[model samples]
Target: MWFRNLLVYRLTQDISFDAERLEAALAGKPARPCASQELTTYGFVAPFGKGEDAPLVHASQDFLLIAARKEERLLPSSVVKDALKEKVEEIETAQMRKVYKKEREQLKDEIIQAFLPRAFIRRSQTFAAIAPKLGLILVNSASTRRAEDLLSTLREALGSLPVRPLSVKVAPSATLTDWVKAQQAAPDFTVLDECELRDTHEDGGVVRCKRQDLTSDEIQLHLSTGKQVTQLALAWQDKLSFVLDDKLVIKRLRFEDLLTEQAEQDGGDDALAQQDASFTLMMLTFSEFLPALFEALGGEEIPQGI
Candidate 1:
């Protein structure tokens, strides 16, 4: 919690790619031009330049977050509006739906870049942000100790507004691998042990989950510093499904898919350090998961691999 010298942000990655060709397609441009750049133009920037060899890596930009001693109490909204006008869509910009649909994230990035550079003018010892679009307000020392006060005030100021309020968050500057591992093995890991498997007609052969809003032990185990995860469910369509903190949904996955994503997010393929979505999903399917759970519950075993 020593935030005096630290800076934190919870900025959503913005759209930093071209949408003109896609717009042209929507405007009845030739098929060849549109078809050629289908997936190519939708390229994503690799995190930390890991996939430099991949051709589509051209679509991404390295994150621009920085730690600075805040100098202003309030950011000038006029400044933000002038800079981010292009990012927001109105009736005029709505004509070419493809531009907005395809490049939504890119537009978000531009909006952040246009944010006013200020945090708070109030001397109540609460952290704030100039704009929610830019980075998160991670920590403020001369601020209040109540995290909810800081978050609630910010949300109240902007939640009802058309524009999203800039958020304030606190997180360690660790590698993604460490972050995933910590999440997977947190002390509140009851969700990993208590899972429900019901026979289903779905491709995965069954449904397994614990209700997030049940107001029970199962739901409480996986709660984060915030209710980051509202639900965690798994589905199999020759692949697995995962939703984390109600925000990160990993679907259309296979056994290898989990590891692949883990490798990408964790920044290492140690295999042993598999995170929850992939690790827990692997246990739910390939491991002797069903039988063990039934036995643990003091019920007749459902049969191995059930």
Candidate 2:
């Protein structure tokens, strides 16, 4: 599956487990349904839904895909408080006395406990790739908090999944602005039609442009006034297009062209073959693109002894 956004991280320590051992460990941590009165359950799961027969870890040589699932009961605090208030009012009316504040809070907890079991359950899945080969983990998300949730769950399963956010030598805003001003690309990248520039002020201003000349004198004027490029859209060769943000995250990725060319080259009519081909193409392309992109952003420098 293609990732729409990337939350890139670098592994801080060596991953000792090989594919087989990793798979077995993940199988031992397969996701379980939320129990009654349980707020949430977190664990690993089969990426492609093969159930017990399916390997919890999907390995493609050195690249591994770990799918994490979180099932949570949708019991809103407001709903519980309202129900508790109703119960408190009912008690007051029956006994013809006002309920104490502490007693009301106790009733609130009781209402929440009684409501959780029957609350509707919502399940969410986050798929992250472990490329111990490259010492990297790429989670398909733009939100750092959500990515951290996945990483934390993985850490609990593996006992020590030490990773840090991918860091770059140069600030992305400075690099992107220089690229636009010089009208030169970073290695294999080409400037696309979208960009976002922001003023370097406390109440900073923002400028977003689409389908406009990035190197035009008008755009350059903003750069002259200290408005740095916070986000720049670029295409990596003909394979991928995405916006590079200041936080080193890639967003709004489009792989339609790559997928179409791959589908035609593979010449597959069968659904299963097509699926396999898509995965193959993604693995081949991303393995190359990630390193290049990292270099373009000034390369990664992970800390020692994490």
Candidate 2 residues 1-306, lDDT tens each?
Answer: 667888888877777758788787776677889999899988888875565787777776567777888899999888987898889889999999999989988998898889988999999988888787778888988989889988887777677887889888888888899999888878889998889999999999999999989989999999999999999999998888999999888999888675767765684786545644665577677889988987887876655554
Candidate 2 runs further than 4 Å off: 91-101, 263-273, 304-306
Q: Give me the candidate number with maximum TM-score.
A: 2
The Cα local distance difference test for each model comes to 0.30, 0.83
**Cα deviation in Å at residue 30, candidate 1?**
36
TM-score of each: 0.17, 0.88
TM-score of 1: 0.17
| Model 1: residues with Cα > 4 Å off, grouped in runs | 1-16, 19-230, 244-306
Q: For residues 214-306, could you state the per-residue lDDT of candidate 1 as single tens digits?
A: 334543343322222232333323333332221122222234455456545653454333322333333234223222322322333122232
**lDDT for 43 (candidate 1):** 13
